[model samples]
Structures are given as C-alpha cells and as structure tokens.
Target: SFHHYETPEDIRSKTMEWIEDFHADTERNATLWTMEKLSKHDGSDPENYPAHVCVMEFVVQVGADTRTFPSWKGHCVTRRNLVHFRGLSIDKNDIRWNEDGFRPLPDLACCLEKEKEYLLQNLETLLHRGGRIVARLKEHLEDQDQSRYTLP
Candidate 1:
C-alpha cells in the first residue's frame, strides 16, 4: 500500500484557512488562536494551554496476540495523520497524554481545505480584519518574548 502526504505549502495553506475561518467569528475569535508554526513541544507547556489546531503525523503499532483484542505485530500504517489542538498540560512526564488533543484526519490533505474556495472568494473580508489580526499576532510575539526571560 502507498500513502501520500501533502507538501508543506499545501498543509500550511490549509491550516491558515482554518485559522482565518475561526477568526471570522468575532465572538469566538476573542479567545485568540496563537502560534502559526507547528512545534514538537507544543501543548506541553502550562502557559500555552489550549493551543490551536495543527497537523502532525503519528505511527501506531500493536503487538500480535490472538488471545488479546485483535492485536497485530507490525506497525499500523493506516490513519497516521491527526488534527491536534486544544491541548492541556496535566502531566509533564507523559507527552502522549499531554498532546492527546487531536482528532484523526482521515484525509490529511483535505482536513482543513473544505473552505479554501469560499475563503478565496471572501478574501476582502479577511483583509479588512487585518487590524485585529495584527494586534493578536503582536500580542503573541510579545508574549513569547516576555516568557523567554525571568523578571526576578
């Protein structure tokens, strides 16, 4: 069997589309969807709880054991991609648990592409919201800067 992964550009474009859509909802957008780039350490920090959605690939495998519930020895190649978001930092040691904020992306390439065409048509609206967007982005960067150093 063969699998196909979207190019980084495609993935990024789709992610942006989802974010832009989320931003369109004025009431909901107030919550702030920070972080444009993906991170391995994402969702692991207490300060950054509820990180917005991002895509990542995970490989799962099960041991072959007939007596146990439908076990297999080899890696499970299917359904490797996921839409990760809304993470919580409960236990620092358990990364899997901390980053469990996800939903299986059946088609990784299309997960966030549903409104691409529609968003393209409404680009003007998004552009008009630039002020809010810029403010939020500035806040995000400033937060990063402040968090990098200890004031004490």
Candidate 2:
C-alpha cells in the first residue's frame, strides 16, 4: 500500500523524519565519550583546561554479531570536545560510507577544507586566544600554588 504525496514539501518532511529516525537508531548503538566530562578528578568537577586528546580506536560494526570493518589501526585525534582537528585518519580505508551507500569523500573534503579555511582565517585569534586561555589557567593554578593542580 503506497500513498503518493502531492507536494515536494510532504516528501521532504517524510524523508527527513525517516533519516532522523535512522540516525537515532545508529546513535543508540554507538559509544560516545566526552573527555571534558570523563577527565574530571571528581564526577562533579569541571575541566580547567582542554585535554591532550587522541583517538584510541574506531571500528565499524553491523548489528551485534557482524563486524563490517576492523578497528582503525592508527591513533589520531580527529576532533576535540568542541573544536575539530583536521587531517586525522580514522581508518585505513580512504573513505567511509553510510547505509545508503553515499561515500563521504565530498562531504569530508568539504568539511576539512572549511575547517582549514576557518583555522587559517582565525589563526592569529586562535593562537592568541588559546594562549591567553592557557595563561589564565596557569595563573589560577599558580595563585592556588597546588602541586595537584598541575596536569600530568
């Protein structure tokens, strides 16, 4: 039983809903760890500075029993808690694809290029602001004068 839509808007909305549901399902099975939340000394404590990050592993699986791909051998931090780092390879494969068979080269390339452009455009601000943020954290730690405050 098929009900054809009369308008593109109806079709678009239905498609969007379907895609949203699909993503929801995928996220249910995926593991997500936030470093800022995970790295805190106490469960209630907040992170004073950004963590030196790295990707421990990445693997693509289908359902519980099927292993679609092996875990990515190399370690690289593709993203931070908020900001994304570029040129990190998640796997040996050149590209990853979705269930709909859409290869992510174009999208990844676009995202990487946009990220690079953003970094280039804001390099001075990023460096200076980042330095200032670090300096402020250092000053706070120094004012406290606690050996425990220092990051290992």
Tens digit of per-residue lDDT, candidate 1, span 71-126: 11111111221111112232332122214421122332343453233223232222
Which residue pairs clash in candidate 2? none
Q: Cα miss at 18, model 2 (Å)?
A: 0.5
Cα lDDT listed for each candidate: 0.28, 0.26
TM-score of 1: 0.23
RMSD of each: 17.0, 19.5
How well does each candidate superpose onto the true structure, as a TM-score? 0.23, 0.19
Give residue 3's lDDT in candidate 2 (0 to 100): 39
Name the best candidate (by lDDT).
1
lDDT of 2 by residue, 22-96 (tens): 346665324443323222312122244222211211211112222111321111122221032333343332322
Q: Model 1, poorest ten-residue lDDT window?
A: 68-77
Worst lDDT 10-window in candidate 2:
131-140
